[model samples]
Target chain A: MKKYKGYLIDLDGTMYKGTEKIEAASDFVKALAEKQIPYLFVTNNSSRTPEQVAEKLTEFDIPTTKDHIFTTSQATANFISGKKSNASVYVIGEEGIRDSIVEKGLQINDMNPEFVVIGIDREITYEKLSIACLAVRQGATFISTNGDIAIPTERGLLPGNGALTSVITVSTGVQPIFIGKPESIIMEQALKVVGTSLEDTLMVGDNYDTDIMAGMNTGLDTLLVHTGVTTVEMLQSIERKPTYTVGSLEEWIEKM
Target chain B: MKKYKGYLIDLDGTMYKGTEKIEAASDFVKALAEKQIPYLFVTNNSSRTPEQVAEKLTEFDIPTTKDHIFTTSQATANFISGKKSNASVYVIGEEGIRDSIVEKGLQINDMNPEFVVIGIDREITYEKLSIACLAVRQGATFISTNGDIAIPTERGLLPGNGALTSVITVSTGVQPIFIGKPESIIMEQALKVVGTSLEDTLMVGDNYDTDIMAGMNTGLDTLLVHTGVTTVEMLQSIERKPTYTVGSLEEWIEKM
Candidate 1:
């Protein structure tokens, strides 16, 4: 399309799931590569790193690197860095989240930190929770990667970092500055990275809440796929319908 | 206890699952029954009626009746009735949604409806969406039950009626009068039904976005159950922590 030069795509549900790649997804990427089209696999789930996501894509035979991936974690980190260039922080999270916070050259400490950056920490303990609440209540600007309370999986929906954010919110009565999907924060970053105009580019996602809304909110076209969290029936029933519906990434490429 | 004399509790995900009862959820009602507690079952899920929810509860061995139930459909109907007295409504919904529209003593027709009452209609048609959008754009007061974008199920998360409202919102830039949980619309009715003082009454549900927030928005003490849409981790991590946390309704009895 003459109107668009690049695309901003979502991972987890939009691309390969685990080691199993969706049919035509690889071929579509190959086509993009052959056509010299640029795309970034962005995700709101901040628990993983872009490197990790890229690795997963590589395993599925989709050639990728960290440069082609963007995450809510990254955006949050960038936002934090921009807002607080010299702030010390207490990180309630894992290596990925910790790295995101520390990557900005900001200090990470448990003792009287300037901010409490709450990310997805699987090993989160009561002490960490208490410390996070304390930090925020003490005026530390609490920020989170995304508000996805639960993540959908093949098994079922699992409580994501949104669950933790909820607890911290209740204790502090302060909502974290969210920097992920369906929010203007991450979309701005994606738009910058791809250098794609919103009108021409499309947001391909399986979730209506995050993906579709993100695109629609940013004035981009939206493509809904049934292979992820939401079904076509679900989309049809809703008052807000996406711009286009596809069965999978393969069908999406066919249309493209 | 000193202030409120009754209660109005939402049913879907709060009272029962697809066909199962929430833990100790019945005991709370039974305790109310023993103490001659006045409570009503209010729900935003228009998929069924008060009769169905009551029957499902009875099947689980918790006796309930139509008199003790109020649906958003019912609430919206009452709201419309109180406001317009008698006006024709362009109803975009199911049997429950339709019946509620009529309950307001309003005539239902697509010809020249003065207002548009939007609800979660499973068999949604493109024609309906267009009509509602047109009607709202034409200066009709648009009303919605809730803004819940997704509904969780055994299968997966489906686009809830809230998504419908979003579509209309984006198109018209007009927000509807939301009358469901977390909005303080129906929760007021629930309070009236239970005859419980706002100071002593407690709300327990599994969803943080609706059930718990509904209580938080109101002055009622809230207990977040971990059985349905929300989990233990979510309860622990939120910034808007509930008054109390329990793994299940059964665990709630232990608190008492």
Candidate 2:
């Protein structure tokens, strides 16, 4: 196996399966830490701040700090900043996205914004949607953190940011620029954050659709683990297979 | 001109535009009243009760009663009642839909309902959407009052029932049975309510997409009036034309 200089890894399914730690995943990260391999956890979850995600990883015995996380929220903020620094944004999201946008020195304006950014917001309301629709109709650049239609929960799949974003999209007849995995924008942002050249970096995740596709979309080699989401049967149906497939993260630890 | 035994007319664009009453529309309805031509106002608005709509029409001097109005909420209730009497439903809408369901003896149940119905709600919340998505994922038959993506308001075109419905539809990957204009289900229910045969009834409206398409879908002759949404240029683009076209209701009043 060719050794990559840096790694961009997915959280949730790849690292752990929703609060339950994957022991092999912990060992894999520990091995990377031991080998001094630079790695960053890239996630589509825009509701959680880097500290919260790092804390979660720490609980799972995976060595991680706030700087080791690249959230979609951060990517989204950086994306807007790149386009136009100090851009006025009307944001619909939880603390993560809000914090990211604020930290980036962007103006938060509801009346007339330069951009309308949507992330997963549990406290989503019709009024917020109305404001977003109005802003979009007024020619604001629409952007969504991710296009995850459903979020997996204990009860069942709940409505995700993509579904919520549809209200503004369907109403205003405006399509949002989605920045999460599977879309090349987030991958490019993650690559820049990790300071890795595309050819020398490996994108690792358990999901074929998001993680693996993100890697492929950004022209990076991908390693798909079977710890979560995509099963071997599900993977077989896909036309373009991941560069590497492993039964567990333990199998990929040797390469690090 | 071929005289029709009954008329299924649209509100908003046809009778009035927002709060402004169409002067010629009042005369047309008066002519229908004088001729004793049975007419029912079929509306896609599931937020207003039949009584409320009738009251509005009365204010405009467009001879109407509670019995002469058939809202999508009532149509939705009738549609559900036809399938299973007193069926439990998880509703995500306003008082109009709520009242219609209860009045029809149907139960409003949030947990494990037989059906999930969506209508326009200005006070839409994430919790309501979550419940609807959960219900739909649990195998509930999903239904939307209408598929009108944008609702015309003084501010501008706001998110409509169809746009709100996309949350559950996109999240659950379930396409709802839309029970409004352009759907034969609502038209069939309206036909039964007005006691009119499809061949003998004439549908009149200003919007070609909803009213004209509804009539066309139900095999009813449609009269397109150029007072509201669908303009002459828009009508020319459509492959299937309305049976009759007029500049105003005053032109149709002569035929009556």
Candidate 3:
């Protein structure tokens, strides 16, 4: 616990799932406040903007400023902006994708887009799919925010934007340049927000495949939380293991 | 038409769709018969076996034998068999996938598989996904039957097993070696079947993106059919034009 200075935390499965927030998530927030240690809420879910995520976190009684949030959406936009400063893009996604692209000062139009940006388009129509496919086949760059296939819902799992991306992939047979978490782009942003040396920072989350994998890929100490998506049973059965395993952030705070 | 020996046709858009066979499909077959033109039904649709496809074609009263049919599943199995000879595979697909893999004299079990062979798992599950991802990341070769994300349905086009393939991709960053039509891998198999030269082979279909693009990529003559998934409106709007466009395969026979 003494080795960790700043925490790079995950949202969604780690903190909350839909309307129901995690039990010890609030305690983790309080621990951060009491310790006065820097931490940033980072997520691979590109469905929401940083401001949107902050609002959700604040609504859950976890104090979150806009500055404390970073998303894959932000990383993707930054990456695209650097590559093509003013290229046109045809988007097949939601407000998050459009806003991120626009923030990077990229243009989004119906025709002659230099790239067909496929993000998480939950409201995907056949018309939109056809348009996105057409633009990509004409030699436009294809970029996606994240590659999550399905999101767990109250009733069941629903297909996410990754499904929409596959539509274009089938047409073009080209993979998108994914610039989200674990891709080194968002990890850089997280490192900046946490303001801790990479060696001293810790990423605490539930999903080992995404959260722990991203931290490991970015050279950060990772803590595996086992209450959310990846349950204790699932973790114990797995062959690949994590650095540090904790029941909840509250337990970690007690140890600290 | 004069430059070709006989056409190696594709199914779906090239010949028929569902219960509503293309208007000129039967007539086109008759023309081929009259001219003693040898043609093989090559399809990337891994859902149905060659025999199943042949049966469906016969339902339309079009003369098709099991011997005259070749499928991507068959090609994929042949590829894997030739490489490993008798390696074990963890099969996560349907009858077509199992039949093909078994036909190649390959051993399949639940143990440590040499490869995790992913075909069209129409009824895809989270357990299968987790297993496949884990197996592939653990150094098992991840081979995809084809890369078609969606197949046509009465409701609309539904995302296929190829959509699921992206999960393994985002997890491992390992591109799948797809053995299906439009890819040179399957095209080579179809060519080998007919003993036909690439110049003489015509890849005919309704979809310009996959079928036509595959033809274009492999230097095979292509004919875009109007009666399938792609409408004339959609075709006219896109810049990736097909080599030749036809109202129907029956009408295209007139050219020959």
Q: Number of the top candidate by TM-score?
A: 2
lDDT of each: 0.73, 0.92, 0.76
Sorted into a CAPRI-style docking class, model 2 comes out as: high
Off by over 4 Å in 1: A1-3, A153-155, B1-256
Candidates, DockQ:
0.02, 0.84, 0.08
Score chain A of each prediction against the true chain A by TM-score and list the results.
Answer: 0.93, 0.98, 0.92
lDDT of 3 by residue, B112-226 (tens): 6888877766565545655665666567888888877766656445555576566566545678888876687887777789777887777777777777877777778878888
Q: How do these models rank on TM-score, best leading?
A: 2, 3, 1
Instruction: Report the Cα lDDT for residue A231, model 2.
Output: 97
Q: Which 10-residue span in candidate 3 chain B carries the lowest summed lDDT?
A: B155-164
Top DockQ: which candidate number?
A: 2
Q: Candidate 3: which docking quality band?
A: incorrect
B10-59: candidate 1 lDDT, tens digit per residue: 56666778667676677877866776757777677765666766777887
lDDT score, residue A18, model 3?
79
**Which runs in model 3 stand beyond 4 Å of their true positions?**
A1-256, B1-3, B230-243
